[model samples]
Target: MRKQILFLLALSLLCISFTFAQNNVQQRKIDSEFLNAVHYYENKDYDKALTGFDNVINNYPLNSKTTASYFFRIKILIGQKEFERAKDLTNYFIETYPSSRYIDEIRMLKVKLYVDDSEYFDALKEIAFLIDRTKSISYRIEAKTIGGQIAKSYLSSSDLLRLSNAFTGETVKPYLLLLLGKAFLKEGKKGDALNSFTRIIGSYPHSAEYFEAKSLIESPVSGEETSSGQALVGVLLPLKLNSAGEPTSNTAGEILDGIKYAVAKFNSGRTDKIGIVIRDTQNNEERIKQIRNEIGYNPNIKAIIGPIFSNEVRIAINDFDATGIPIISPTATDNDLTSESENFFQANPPLVIRGKIMAQYIFFVANKRLMAVLNSVDGYSPLLAATFVDEFSRLGGTIVTRQTYKSNSLSFAEQFANIAIADSVDGIYVPLAEKSDAPAILSQMVQDSMYVPLFGNQDWFFAKGFETSPELSNMLTFSSDFFIEFNSKDFQEFNNEFSNITGKDVNRNILYGYDTAKYLLTVMKNVDKNRTAIKTKMISGLTTRGYHNNISFDKHRMNRFLNIVRFKDGVFELIERFRSGSL
Candidate 1:
């Protein structure tokens, strides 16, 4: 009797253990499926993700994976723009998991759905409810932010009036007035728009829409006597740096002269003209701030042109962006600046793009499969070299060796000594733009008789006496966006006119200023004369043919073209031009 009882107990325990292990394995499989669905959602494979999420939901009943699958399914549906399906899933999630922690998130997503569909009234109603009730800080902020956007959209006066009546939130009112002003302007009711803008400016001076309203009131579209019927643009330059900083007055003068010439040329050709307001930033942060504030209220300045140093640009971009004023930087090439603000547009292409341009030329045009890089430690040089390295390797080209020197280093011996001039190295890339370092590297190469074709960036041509160096003159090629051929008839004529006015030879700064001003003026003519419309239009993928290159903008607002130039008999000759969107 005892043995029989023991056997029965043993059999029951074994069955229980086996059942537990099997359940564990099944749970793990469901968890894995849920994770895979998440991965698919992240990778933007909406269809597969939906199938995977549905599988988890059906197979993992009342489990954590099932709850997560429900939330993400709704999110994916929303991403795919299946609004009705998302609405259904959301309702199902609320009914199925009444105690889920993601309720706020789901509600926020619903608010986004309404806003995206331009159901502004519905969005506002939901946002007002969220702001009043939700304790989740992030959720409340998201709801209020969307409320602001809804107020900014182009809406009928009736719709605007309805929104105002529905939601009297302090944060949402200013943006509504802003949109109202723009709508009034769109109807050619400048007086009504001005009245609306004035009310906002007077009542809500610290509101988010205040800067834009002030801008519109100050620089309206009508060619009225107050606005002088012209596009008033501002130019901020570091014309006079401190004594410690190099005095680049001549460069600033040339740039200014070019802008003046372009404006004069433009005005002479057309009845609609642009006027420029020049401000010297003095290369100081405080000065830039002061000037920006002054320009911010100046009623006459519609757009801004410069503040060339990266540091100064960083200071001014946010202010200009808030005011709906477009500021174009001609020479600041820091790639990080592109993300600083929307209104900050770079007229010079970034160094990384230049590096790719060099790589493409060496790979396809020069047919050099193996290359070596000589680099310098500077803000700009290493980026150029690394970009070239990445691109060259991607093109099936080999980087035989890379060497670097400290900035302002006089000797290239140590940097160059380790580079073995292999037979495979068909070219050498010199990624320094300075006058001394580039020529020093080239001279060392010449002494060793390693006559490889040397490649350089735009700064290589900026050196004054580079052409006089016999070792540096031949097999030397660099890239730039500005190259004026004296023999070209049109250039010759422009040169004469520019010389007559400025008594100075036109240089790179001049070319950039001319190009930037001309481009802005052309855009001004096409876009609405109001500040908001002009600002939006400038960022809307506008492109134009400039003097030496085609000026188009990338999504980040960086100039999109680079011209590869070769040095021959003291002149930099344009060998090839590369556009970012093209090969």
Candidate 2:
């Protein structure tokens, strides 16, 4: 009986060992499949990779590969743009594999996905969670980078409270300091911003932020080495002395009047001041070259303005390379010039800046849901349309349609009809240069039963035919830099002075010219006629209490304040004023 019992025990042991061996083989197979899935996923063949991972999960439910498989499957879902599904899978992975090494990476990816989908608040929540949960240095750096970007976006519109809240602790202190400086700069608080930047320079000397901080603070003010008395101001303009098919020279004449007025005012009380020199390019390339050659030899010419056409501006930039003379265009609205020339500045707001402001006004101020952009054939029109699209989309708004039309084309009924068929867009933005075209566009839209609100640039108010077109008058909203309706007495007094000097009514462009002169004079009073110093003053958001607006400059030297106007009963009225911080 003892021998029989020993044989049975031995057989049972052998059977148990065999079953264990089979289980090991199966687990190895699942592990191999899971690794293969990861390889395919890295190769971007997400469909097959997902299938393989699913097979691993189904075949080896309790194996070591299970957690890894869940993690990788979440990645594949994200790659496929299946965000909602990927979010659910990520939650599952976090719950089931709480000890997984990739938890922080998964959380970062979730933040990125939310950002990509325009779910900013949700992304902020994930960032908060990651900051609260993780001690990993890499993850903390990532959180700071993302948080800084979001804070900068809010700061663009002058939302400082949100920006301040974004950086809370010592871990993100450096980035917060830099961002606070930028925010203060946006709100026209130069002293504060400068202080913040100076702090970074002093405290974080070894960091990369210190390098950028130093570069910014040093570049703009360096040009002030030359004195105003020693420097010559170059004015490049198309004088339009003889041009066919042009209006009664009212616009150019008014511009020149404003320039002369500024110069006269500056020369009135000052002794040994900088002299203003004018160069008329006549909108010709050869003339521009001659003018550039003349200015190139004269060291007295420290700055320039005008060359109103976009092509002319390009020529001027190429001809004046490394001259260190800043060119401020009084009327040019082209966007490409600024990108090409660091020395270039636009006294009139660029189309892109105006477009961005218009988008913000419509989406945030007016609370409009859907926006449609109607673009003209003018070169600036496309840029305006594109900027509106980009800024609106960035702010979590949808663009209903982008319509393009040839200048002087009368029949827009078909285009209006098609736009009307699109889901009800609450606002429409038409950037047309010619007033004659405004009535036709508005008439077609109104005839098509499209009563949605319309928005446009200041040009709409100056358009000639808009006065008689009731439909256009009723549906129009526009933006301008200056308006006569400001309740401030200082503005009224300035308007009176401007009218007396120029003999023209006060408008946005006039205000721009006056402010431009005021700004130049202000710089002249404080700094020598050095282009660098003037640029620094311009970029530093120097405060100017002007007739049109409380003006300041951004990093790119674009004006930060815009007045929102609406046309009612045949006149443009200032409906609201928009500044950086006031939303």
Candidate 3:
């Protein structure tokens, strides 16, 4: 009986050894196939890469390399523009490996593929899933953004109505209604527009689009109230102009939409119509020069908003300086814009003032007495650092070290060594020209064991890798012209919509235009609509709270409402609402 039991144990042990050997051989095959696929992908031999990746994924589904194989296979399909096939595989991967490490990435790719294929309904379905359940805040936000574009631009009125009725996510309904209202307005369905806006104001009062919808309600009475006089405001932008005055992109249209929306809202219940005459400079300096006198001398044109490009503004301002018209560049950040033209009001403050303001905040608000400065030798960073050094020095602060380096040199060891921020350095002011370089900077700083507080410009807040490396953020404080409030996501939604339309960054240009127009037009009602009157009102400090920025132009004619923010616990927290100091 004991020999029989021993024989059974030996047989079981031999079976287990054979099973282990088979598993090892399977893992090795998967690893080898996956490696070859990676090599093929690196060499751009996508067909072979896809074949190898598919073999690993299908033949060894339980192997560790299988998930990676699926990822590579999907990537190759996407690169080959086989979005439908990529989406099918993505869905299969997600379903098969429900808890795979690559799940979220594959799902994100799935959403994009749906969007790319113009399968808006399916894309929205995927977006709805990710917005609530994804572990990625950025992915959640991007999902919301893409969803907004589908609602705002892609969806027809009937589709919007259908989706609004069918989609029961309370947070999403109001956004759809807001887009529906805009669509109605586009089609001249004013009553329908009113109804859509009213639904949001009544039902979704707490929604991110609440304030915007409330601001857009039509006049309470039947027609606009008969006001005293017509207030004409001229809009000078690169609105709907390609090379030959054709519509190249929607960025200019977005700016115009804000101004026009502000005008429409301003005229909603009021009898006095604020007329806007838009001159498309096409972002062309010569075009601005050509149209300068045409819009300049028009006696009815009271206030001028834009000619958005800084150089275009410089040219227009030079041409219109003698006209004494109030020219507000909603997006220009060039320091020379204000210096050259007294009539120019920059809603977005120039680089110099941004630096100076941050310096002021460190000295006055934070009470930091000593600081180190590190910036690139050229472009925005050095200019930012120079003004900061000037302002900090003028404000009775000591500069421990001012270090300059060549741009794009990932090796910051030498510069960090030179800063020597070991003692009495209250803060290190490192302004970066490219946000892409932030990871290298953060990594080098972490390696050097530099744990001092960092003061930087707005670019730092948007740095990609910083979210994953919050330890390197230390106690970062920065200045920005705009702040995106997740609590108020209507404009944030529009932000993404514009990005989709332009395929480029729109960085709150809509709000820049809206806030400037809203600020100026509000003043136009109080004072005479003449150029001098508008200019005086702006100079005397007319402050209006805006969506992305606060409008309170100080004596220097730059935006004084720069937001000071800090990185706390892996999130950006507003430290101060708006703060700026004198030159």
In order, the Cα lDDT scores of the candidates are: 0.74, 0.70, 0.76
Clashes of 3: 2
By summed lDDT, the worst window of 10 consecutive residues in model 1 runs over: 221-230
Residues 370-406, candidate 3: write the lDDT tens digits: 8999888867998899899999999899998888877
From the highest TM-score down, the ranking of the candidates is 1, 3, 2
lDDT of 1 by residue, 78-197 (tens): 877899888777767756665678777776777777767877777666666566556775576466556656655645656665655564555556656666676676567888789888
Winning candidate number (TM-score) = 1
Q: Lowest-scoring 10 consecutive residues by lDDT in candidate 3?
A: 219-228
Q: How large is the C-alpha RMSD of every model relative to the true structure?
A: 11.3, 19.1, 19.8
Q: Looking at candidate 3, what is the lDDT of residue 544? A: 85
Poorest 10 consecutive residues by lDDT, candidate 2: 219-228
**Per-residue CA lDDT of candidate 2, range 1-583, in tens?**
9999999999999999999999988878887898898888889888989999899888665777777777788878887889999988877776776677788888888888888888766675566667656778658756856765676564342344354466554434445566667667556676777777798777767543564455445432222243523555676767666566332445555565566677778778777566677766777876776565456434456677666667888888766755667776666767667778887776656667888888888888889878887889775777778877888898889998888898888799767866877767988888776667876886676567677788888777667555455665666787876655656676677668877765766765555565666666666565755667777777776756555655666567666677788777766677766654321
Instruction: Name the better of 2 and 3 by TM-score.
Output: 3
- Residue 105 in candidate 1, Cα distance off native in Å: 28
Name the top lDDT candidate: 3
Q: Is candidate 2 or candidate 3 better by lDDT?
A: 3
